[model samples]
Target: MRFIIEVLLSGLAIFLAALILPDSAASVDGFGWAILAGLIIAFVNATIGTVLRFFTFPLNILTLGLISFIITVLMVQLTSYLMGSRFDVANFWWAAVFAIVVAVIQMLLDGIFGAKPRD
Candidate 1:
């Protein structure tokens, strides 16, 4: 139940990102694409993302934890690549912007839903 809600919230976050960002920055075909992107993002974050974070801990600490956003940007880029035409990011800068938007949405949702921090 909680997992389902988190997935749906992720979908909403991606939908919000697609709506907020300009087409030049990022693009999503529609709600269906957003939902698919959300699922991919969640899966990648849970699996590969964890390992990457662990390995990059030094860089993360050196940057005062700001490097996590770059990791998020990479995850978004990976989702865009895996999804092909359905999701596209213009460039790394745009991916970073989109990542920030998604992070903000996630934070807001977590606050409202009282979801515990993952780490």
Candidate 2:
């Protein structure tokens, strides 16, 4: 249930980010494509990304987690490649911007859907 919720929230974030970016920079065909793209991204992150993170653990720590952001950008680009015309990111900078926007929205969604601690 939690995993499903996360995926849906991610898709919503992606859709929102696509709307935020100019059409030349990034684009999503529709909400359904956004969801599918998000799923591909999640799968890619879970598999390839996890291994990259593991290998770069020391650099990640030394860089104070900046490397993870790079990984996120790569995942976004890969997602675009996997989805073809359904989702597109023009270049690295736009992909980075999209990644940041998606991250921010996803953070907000998690906070809202997350288990709250009792005061």
- Could you tell me the C-alpha RMSD of candidate 1 in Å? 2.6
Taking all chains together, each candidate's TM-score versus the true structure is 0.85, 0.89
**What shift in Å separates residue 89 of candidate 1 from its native position after superposition?**
1.3
Candidate 2, run of 10 with poorest lDDT: 110-119
Best by lDDT: 2
Off by over 4 Å in 1: 111-119
Prediction 1 TM-score vs. true: 0.85
Winner by TM-score: 2
- Across 2-119, the per-residue lDDT of candidate 2 in tens digits comes to 6676778889999999999999999999998999999999889999999999999999999999998899899999999888999999989999999999989888888888844545
Error of 1 at 90 (Å): 1.1
The whole-model lDDT of each prediction reads: 0.87, 0.91
Backbone clashes for every candidate come to: 0, 0
> What is the C-alpha lDDT profile of model 1 across 4-116, one tens digit per residue?
88878888888888889998788899877888899998789888888999999999999998777778788889999999989998889999889889889989988998986
Worst 10 residues of 1 by lDDT: 110-119
